[model samples]
Target chain A: MKTKSTIAIIGSTGNMGSAIAKSLAKGSNRLLLFGREDTKLQTLKNDIHTLNSGADVEAIGCPKDASWEADIVILAVPYAAEAAVAEEIRPYVTQKIVISIANPMNETFDGMVTPADSSAAQELQKLLPDAQVVKAFNTTYAANFAEPVIAGVPADAYVAGDDEKAVQTVTELVQSMGLNPVVAGGLAVSHTLEHMQLLLIQLTVKNNYNWHAGWKILHN
Target chain B: MFSELEKNLRQHITLTTDEFDRVKRYFVPKKLRRKQFMLEASDVCTRMAFVSKGALFSYSTSEKGSINVVQFAFESWWMADLYSFFTEEPSKLYIEALEDSELLLLKADRLQPLLADVPAMETYLRILYQNAYVALQRRLEETIGLTAEQRYLRFMERDGRLLLRVPQHMIASYLGVTPETLSRIRKQVS
Candidate 1:
């Protein structure tokens, strides 16, 4: 039998990272939580241990010297920190699927603050060309990540990358999180998905709607 | 013309020549006169067009009938009202050729068959949609969060090629600013 995929969450102390760790814990996969803050990382480790007794959970403070040899690595840090983090983690990641959830939204609430040609994911991909960079998990809120369904709204997640095998790998991970995975096209198509998230965020703020609303591709 | 199409396809779709032929069979080659509408408001966008040559713009009319340009597709670009194309609902936008154009048009009906016949094309299309979606998200974020000057700088830095290909007015429309305002902003930045 194939060994269950090993998964690591970088910036695991954050809400989104912790939530992803929790979601992956159900699949009998080994989970590694890496973060800059030792106290927060330890709390998350304890929390995951409490909830998922069978899942292997380990937490470590940064300057990640050891190699991260996982089937998948979820970069859950803020957009501002992504470039540096990608640089630091590049040497450690080889032949693994690197998933970037960072959205480069400017702090002033101006939508995305990144260069038009260079998305946070694209930049991360450039930083680690050896790893199959798949952009996923940026659209949905952290709260939605942990919930089976948000207010009965089925959140559809999009997976996009140049690699077919990497996209398939991510599709499975999305399914494991109890969300529908829509193959939204290739790596460049990630621009549209990121824009869709911005539209959703705008609608949420403008209409006083909950961040729980997520998109699904409906086929007749 | 075919080379332009090939280049665009290279960016979006990754398939073997045989696989591309399988998917290409589904598309119908067509020509559009300047200012002709490929798709119009209230029409269901059943097709996506690849610009083999010339240019096209996908836009919407505001309630007052003012045009809001959403996307501009130059040679080798892909143009479609994705929301309308997928949902089969009346499109709120219009897709029209800005210049006399040659195109390879693919309809929704052809998608599944192509996917079935050329499995690699599915990967191509999946990647295409993913890239488009990612761009849309970034644009939306820019519209909401960034200042006008910042947005202009970001747009220029990101799509310098587009700045050269597209007209100033259209760029202003996409940026949600007035053409004169865009000019002034450009002057200030320069």
Candidate 2:
């Protein structure tokens, strides 16, 4: 069964967040959008309404408020911006699914900012000890979210989390967005997911993929 | 995305936009890449998918490593392991996308409410099942009682549209013949 739930996009105005909001707006889920810029949030809400008029999208002022109200919370901000956001929403996100889509790429884009022992999702989970942290959507560029299928394949969205129920929920959400959801492993697997995106960014920067390339595993 | 489904239903029964709108809400949209298995062996089918775009096929594998193609579903056609969906049992069949496909899925739980709320939908379903029953009865009769050439002719008569879309070996499997036998029969028929 398709379970409809309220999802809060904490950084709804950013590229990945807005893309996810627009994509999920097409479905039956209710969205509580929070962001740093009010004007951009309003514009995103309007665009979503244009895309799906019957969509339930609301722009909220407070991150904690949005987190408390939503069943699933997606932190779609950059790795540099997640700490402040996480601290603010920590209390509200207890026992909730908190998705971390941050890639801790260093300035040169060749390495990671996160320490060798921990990934961004792991750090976020450590910060909010009660929340279920899931790492996903960091593998592909935001453009893929608009049209997930490339050639004949849906972009693979690898999801890793400690909570089985939360992972399943995110898997269903990914499937609803028309992408293939592969369960990578537990929350510790976030390290590999982060590194995978780092390599993707490196490949795109070195090659002529034009930031449109994504991961797709071919199997017979 | 529901346009194809609406069109298929309209062919059987007439409904206003309002009624159609109500019926559409009961479905969830799902897209699958080519060769993706929507329903696999030992998995319980929770929902029935109605294809809106692309093609799919249902098949079962034997212990001898041969596949028996049972059905091919194109636009507006529905694919599900009915035994699994109805009885909540594990299925032995495999339903794979023949190409990248867009589908509208109706979960088993919603089926009853949808049918109850929309009587026209019930009528549409009944008509479809009736037609399907007749086609299956004919297929079984030909498969058991008729010769291979007769079966091929009957299959050609009914699924001529699929000839261009489906591969030859799958068609041979559906007709219960080997690839070489099917090739010889095709040459003879021509």
- Where in model 1 is the C-alpha error above 4 Å? A63-67, B1-190
| Whole-model Cα lDDT of every candidate shown, in order | 0.77, 0.85
Candidate 2 A-chain TM?
0.97
lDDT of candidate 2 over B81-126, digit per residue (tens) = 7778879988889888888887777767678989987888989878
TM-scores for all candidates? 0.52, 0.54
* DockQ, candidate no. 2: 0.01
> Which residue pairs in model 2 clash with each other?
none
lDDT (Cα, tens digit) per residue for candidate 2, span A1-220: 3224678999899999999999999898879999899899999999999999999789988887787657689999888988988899875665568899999888999888899989999999988776779988888688998888877678899999988878998999988898899999999999998898899888888897887878887889
- Cα deviation at B95, candidate 1, in Å, is 58
Question: Could you tell me the lDDT of residue A28 within candidate 1?
Answer: 71
Q: TM-score, chain A, per candidate?
A: 0.92, 0.97
Question: In model 1, what is the error at residue B169, expressed in angstroms?
Answer: 80
